[model samples]
Target: MQLLALQPQRLSAVVRAPASVRLVTPASGMSTYRFNKHVISHHFCANCGCAPFGFGVGPKGEETAAVNVRCLENVDLNAWPRIPYDGRSV
Candidate 1:
């Protein structure tokens, strides 16, 4: 699988609108970390401690998801495009 080596502070996520995402299980058990950015609610697995996604309001004032592609199953990671982003500078 191909993966981008993002900066420590950078996260290469796929942005999706809230209505577009359907969760298979309830998210009530996940742990959240805001990283001081209360705007985005970063969620990680309580058992594995791996952050798979986040919820936030987009610039357009719509609910959004920040999904980690690496955590997805049945996907060809190498087939995805790589976009560079500098999160540290944000």
Candidate 2:
């Protein structure tokens, strides 16, 4: 997977998988890290070491998960619009 700095407002596509979905070899499962005021847990593959998505509470106190569009297969990233975001300063 390609490593890039994530910024605010950057478009990302993700799919919500069933909780029953299990991680296998080559996947090496995932690890969580806290960020953005320590309210969110970022999940990444242990083997590939790629962050596929993140989970956390929203402003309304609801659970949410965000997945990386680049992580999905059969998707053409070049066809998407590259928007600028500045999340680091937040």
Candidate 3:
């Protein structure tokens, strides 16, 4: 899945009812794994094997979330500038 990076501040502005967002594992069973020193918690839906989002700490130590924009409805992905992030080097 392609991941779009957004700051928590910006994300809150875009997502309505941000407080209602929750990560739920599917009843069919799903897996949560971490890579690169286990910095982020990657959540995926087992039934469809789709990763809708992930949670991790930002560079400044603030909590951050990376949401898969493709999963969002009515969002024009092309409207946003794509910024390349080299998380592997972090």
Q: Candidate 1 or 3, higher lDDT?
A: 1
Q: Please report the candidate that would top lDDT against the real structure.
A: 1
Whole-model lDDT per candidate: 0.71, 0.59, 0.56
> Per-residue alpha-carbon lDDT of model 2 for 1-90, expressed as tens digits?
222336433436443433523344333356778865897777876677777777677667776666677667896766665544356555
The root-mean-square deviation over C-alpha atoms between each candidate and the true structure, in angstroms, is 3.6, 6.0, 7.0
lDDT of 1 at 43: 89
TM-score, cand. 2: 0.58
Candidate 3 stretches greater than 4 Å from native: 1-30
Candidate 1 vs candidate 3: the TM-score winner is 1
Off by over 4 Å in 1: 1-11
Clashes of each: 0, 0, 0
Q: Please give each candidate's TM-score.
A: 0.78, 0.58, 0.62
Error of 2 at 50 (Å): 0.9
Steric clash pairs (candidate 2) = none
- Clashing pairs for model 3 are none
Flag the better candidate by TM-score, 1 or 2: 1
